[model samples]
Target: MSMPPPNRTKSAHRSPALRPVGPNSLMADLDLPPPTNPHVQPVLDPIFDEPDDHGGPVDPVVLAAAMSNLNMLQKQRSNPHSASSSPVDSGPSSPNFQNGIPLAPPMSSGNSSSVPGTPHFGAQTELLKALDESTKVIRQNSKAPTRAPSVSGIGAVVEKPDYSEAKIVVAMVGLPARGKSYLSNKLMRYLRWLEYNVEVFNVGQLRRTKARHEQEAGKGKADHSAKFFSHSDPKANAAREQLAEESLEMLITWLKAEGGNVGIMDATNTTIERRDKIRQRVARDPNLQLLFLESVCTDPAVIAANVALKVQSGDPDYAGMSREEAERDFLSRIAQYERVYQSIEEPGISFCRIFNVGQRVFMNLIQGYLQSRIAFYLMNLHLKPRSIYLSRHGESIYNVEGKIGGDSDLSERGWQYARALPNLIKDNIGDGPLEVWTSTLQRTMQTGSFLPFEKKTWKSLDELDAGVCDGMTYEEIEEKYPEDFISRDEDKFNYRYRGGESYRDVVVRLEPVIMELERQENILIIGHQAILRCLYAYFLALPQDQLPYIKIPLHTLIKITPMAYGCDEKRYPLPIQAVDTHRPKPLRQRKNTLENTPILSAEPDELVFQSTTARDYFGHLPPLSVGTEQVQEDVSADTKLPTGGMIKTHGLGLAVEPGALKEALERGQETGELTPRAIAER
Candidate 1:
């Protein structure tokens, strides 16, 4: 029996610019017919227009019918150009991604005893070569990532039009106590993770700062009583408007001064007059795109939660007041704003209304890649409380040998840690539906082998690919590729190896994984060090540039709970002995000054020199579960050395931080100031 093919038609929210303009494109010159344009947009799609109940949930039956109509719109006609074309890709359309969904097929890592990174179903060299000549014209002008090029720029004689260069200003809309700030903060984090220069300016914070300044000067009374928000109070209203203006001015100044990509004005622009004032100001700048994001929550339970959160967080307005009094006063203030709050009937301005945190979404007049991307992201949000547990796979034979990236089975101690994992998780997570996730590597899978929960393996979770250097010790790498070693140390985040990937590349491939994690509830991810570091950086909201050096020790688990405006994190290290593979950021030293470099030794009898990075490969063993002492150090030297570990293996899975191992060697290993055997016996 044959199953139905997935829908490949365009959604109402898809950008019109994505349509094929065959008449003027390079396709016209090639005498090839353009892909058929499926104008299957339905009038009832709330994303394009408005939903009934004025931005509430759409009728489920109607939504289902619209989706059916969309899928039915795919015409199964023959392509006049190719006679062998099947209905799999009817007409002239490409079979690949006519739909926006990702199409990653299963991959097999061909015979490799060592750990395998994401595999390829087959080679793509010939396919890449076939497109080289055809794509050369458009490839001549290289633009930055995330910037879309115009059709005229593709070597066609079409009219040259202005390309998109919109500096967006996202203005918040809703009554006080709504999740406006929550949505703003999350959006800022997501955009930042994607390498966009985004910033947020909260109007309430501005007003609070001004009040504190006046209090310090003792020039005016600091009054934030409920009366301050009353619609009838002209004086307070004027002050609020003034503060809003100041925040907007700061956003504009930052965008112009720093050449920012997205700037947000976080405030309750609830009234029609307030939204209009914002539009008038934004219209003055030719390239400034204003998007009003309205968060509408009718659920009393959600509203109550938001109110409680604000009051307990010690909102500056409720400072020095009891919880009861603060809650009472804040509710009164919300009442005052509610009196004048409008449902946002803006005539021509682009806006989106999120009802009950994406139970339903209504977007109107929103176009362009950036604006639509923002709306799409908003559709995935939820206010539910959930925690994501992250852990690196336990110790492997590669870790014992100071090698990186392999699918080797866990060592004896690694198996011990894996066995203890379920209890540690059960103790912390305590009785819930927790699924287990791992990379498609033997090490990660073995680490989670004991887990009694639903499990999944993601190729995207595979360790960083080392390209040409897969399975060589760090010492061998420096000796063979000195300049490449230095390049990695200098820009760890963006430095792509000769044939492998960069931290930035890993971030790009992990987009789907991140989106899924955001949508899920409780899940435990047992992954590689590089993979876990990337996930940890995202949950902690660390800067992307710092991702390469995040210390994710083996056998330690991290618990990350999502919050309304941020994430709360905690770390738990098990009573398991694992090799210390941490390497800090290295010092910037010129040639001839690169001293005290650590070199790897397969046996205690051999020594390699001038390696420019260090690790005690045959000296210090993994830490003990109980404690460290002189006796254990002596035992480690005699027992752990020459324990039949593999040699000359390379990859970045368990490798020391690129260059920081040099600094560590300089400070402790070479100088003997903090030797491995320094615990009362050096």
Candidate 2:
């Protein structure tokens, strides 16, 4: 039996756009009145068509009524300019253009309500329109050339252009080797996973390329040395400024002309002169936003580690130089940068200062959803090198029977695999601090039962929900839902099971889980095939189209170690035999389901891990509980900051000491990401 890709945890809060709205939810706390149809719950069960493990849901007469309304919303979003769904637009020159949406038109002057007796009828219409505007429907195949535009009043799959998504310029303002590139890559990976278009323009890479070009043309040598970055050297300083300007210009052009959502300037914008130039370029466009990230490390240990890594890698600055010479030269280069380094201090500019790789974080003037997201992710990051072990549960009864999804107990062979897991982990990880996580299902929990480690459960780790076909074999599904089976084969990633989830939904549900994993050090997860696949994809930086197809064989442990710029993996497949659960892509013979599958009102999976440690529970690792720590907030005027975050507010955030970040360049190792409370404090 093979598990699926890895999924994420349920640690972080949902983005506002993804959160459910209406009076029955978190939105209701805003003092909203009940809807006219009070019986319609805010979080309605989607029209899944099939029943879950239990029999069909208790249906109301209008159970399907909401589908039409949802479809209307989907339609409106797809074709915003449709006569049936025209926005209140006065054109680009309108005063409300800054909002990226036109102002709502005034209600009909003479009538108090659209319906005579219903005084709030007009307001309801407006609310419905707003909901319609906010909602979007995504189907990768919706715009297939074979399909014609909907002439029967259905939606043409599309999303309205949201110009309000602020064009953001993220400028890194730290000294060399402070994990700026690492942070930039993490940021890009995360935002891109969430479907945001983000790009990075690295000044160092650009400068290196420029110098290499100049050398090839015999114009000059590749002048990358301590003297090259010296502030006192007018020629070198001017050349450095020129490169900075060129990178910023590239970033600006991409944002404006290429529809880039976020453009990252991955460089040491350490001086005020450099940052001000970036600021001026962004200021010209009111729609644009600038965020400066300064990584400050006071820990000498971490700096030294970072510095060792700096010269050991294939970098142009120290190319062809001996290890000792390279290290010395790089140190000199850092010293030169230190002479003119200036922290971000200009008022009204958004910026974040990450202290010791998120031991603490200081943010100021952060505005916009995108900017806040950027800050939040950084607050939970750390550079501590650690390994992530991903594996599937043992073979199950369902696996032996060629079944797809079920909460089945392990077979005898599966139990053998489970019992072997402990020694396997011990041999590979060697008594390391390992936290074991499993799905709520008995199979996953039972598989990790012998591991002597603190255990936790994540509902997101459960196997893909097979819905109405939970206990059915693939042959059974092929016979019963021929079209559905074929459709799934055609596009497994996006093929959501009726009354269940798709690989895409699994990816979405696992996002927070990924965030938590990023914050941890060593972890062993006993997950399902789909869940493991997703997790593996994230660490490997695999593309979405290939994620669902990644193999996760049973009884195999994949150890992934994250480095500065990449992740390394080592696979250990224990000697255990199990049935094959993998189903290769099937040939497309049909395009739709034969009929509707059963609709089961699903029960929420429990998210709890029962610690079933082996006999050695005597004190191996720390608990996963989050402790609260107060951070200095709204801090202004440079001053001392107390550790553990008790506040003493003046105006600005805790300022970095001069040369503190230089220590980060010299150092490299620190504590892993903080717990939830720590991120919240930031």
Candidate 3:
């Protein structure tokens, strides 16, 4: 299975210095036995004579073949020199030569008599000697018999020239709707045009085939609706897993047979586990090159539109849902996505993000494949950025509800966002090893469900706990515990709900998660609103007070580039119409179990410090007397506390406009606020 190293010799495209030599020209130069009995006349054809076709010189192929034949004759048989002690003057003795017409002389004779200065030789012997000398010079200047060059290279020696059987397998992965299929198709066509044998296996089709097979085998039975839509069913999950494994197996079979040069597997291989399986399968073949392509779309609206279109088109591979059904399907898929993202493990998988802009991205991928040596050269020179990208799951059902945190699945708009993500990535990111990370939450998972990257889920990335307030409306909380609500308003930062967690708690809980992130390279984290905020704040170096207030709007992707000094942040907001689902369900309605699901509690040690003192982290002044009641102040004189605590409370300046601040404060009240005692407790 091992392949020989590639030829490293330089190309020999330039013309040689000497004049063109024909096939027979080299034979003229070789010292062949001359005509023995004077019956044959020496041939006088010019070595540089042109061929009859187009008056051009002899073809290189023909000349090369002729030279090879001559070499074989020289090596396999005895020449005239082996049998004769004295060389005969085998030159043709025609009467025309006797006329004193000075022509090129015959080749040299071994006997001394034929040479000059021999005592027995007559006066005419001088002419014979001169002819012999001239013939010797002609023999020395002739071409040497050798093999013909198969390839065009100067001084390029191919140790193992046979590459006719080499094979490569490439896996094209990306978010769904990111054009994995499109890119796969384009690559197949291009490779075919290049005369390489290519076979493409689309996983979606395989799954359908497997589903039908299972039904026919009577191995399992299920209602059509259940078979098509159920996400939690064990049978469905098993069927899906089996489908993926079988598809890969089939691809391997194709590679072993007529795979020729390249084989591609196009699938929603969004989990590292799947990628690892492929890697393991291909690892047995040393000649096989495993390439990963990840397609991403940064624009949420575009993704949503594409998702809608796919649904409308009724593509068999894609889940063909009506507009309403598509939205529901998107939600269910998001839940599955969350599960996959949470399950990602170590060593990591490498993939390239291909934006679905069109053929440009596909062409770039192909170029990378064909010119990998050049790319490696550039990479060694540090010409490109080593990047890792993370995106939040597209907007989910709970996200639209203005709820702090929940596992509610992504809505229709969310599906659109997911669909567009691939194209955005393709258009913007080019290509390379890319891995995706998401929390084990429905919303985050759904957002990434469409992507084609190897996805891993970290349970640690789950949303912040709302505790006993999990499914409660804001009004319900205010009515049930008015005093507690007021106290929370007084101190939002350190205010932990009776059963839920404080922002500080979230920070402490995420410590291990952050450490893992540091160890990874080029990871994209798709998580919840609050969880993302906490992580984003940590990267941006925002103070504790601002962490909870960070505005992570639905359908917006925030990119944090962590650097030596700090992290750079950029936001790509989806332009889809916001579905206003923020209003809490009526109190009389029974809350959905999925929304009220409880998560594992943090380890006791994860709590870290029981209390943290507020240290004017946001640079805000102390409260000022308002009508002698000493109401909490918004902005007053900048103050300096002991222990290097400086509070530049100039009302948040330009970065935090007055209107934004007011809005933030209103949101803070809706959630909870930090009182003086709470700050001291934190």
- Root-mean-square deviation of every model: 23.7, 23.0, 41.2
TM-scores vs. true structure, each candidate: 0.65, 0.64, 0.30
lDDT of 3 by residue, 183-302 (tens): 565455434422356767776655444444555666553233323423345444444445566667767777776546667787766554456668887888765656666554444433
Worst 10 residues of 3 by lDDT: 114-123
Question: How do the residues 1-682 of candidate 1 rate in per-residue lDDT, one tens digit apiece?
Answer: 0011123344433422221221322352367654342221112222432233212222222223322322232121111211110112211243432242112211122232222232221111222122222123222222123213442111111111112244889999887756887788788888777676887888776666666656656656568799978756655666666678778988987787777879889888866567777888889997788888888776654565556566666467777898668767887787676656655553455777777776656665555445655765676666666788989888888889887666776776776687678789899878887867778888787677656665666677888877667777778777887766776777677665445666766675675567557656788999887888788777666665556666678888888777654566678899889997765556452221223323233333222221111111112112222111112212222122111121112211112232332344344434653332331121
lDDT assessment of candidate 1: 0.58
Shift in Å, residue 393, candidate 3? 2.7
Return the TM-score for candidate 3, rounded to 2 decimals. Answer: 0.30
Winning candidate number (TM-score): 1
Off by over 4 Å in 3: 1-390, 401-404, 579-682
User: What is the Cα-based lDDT of residue 135 in candidate 1?
Assistant: 24
**By descending lDDT, how would the candidates be arranged?**
2, 1, 3
Backbone clashes for every candidate come to 7, 41, 54
Global CA lDDT of candidate 3, please?
A: 0.43
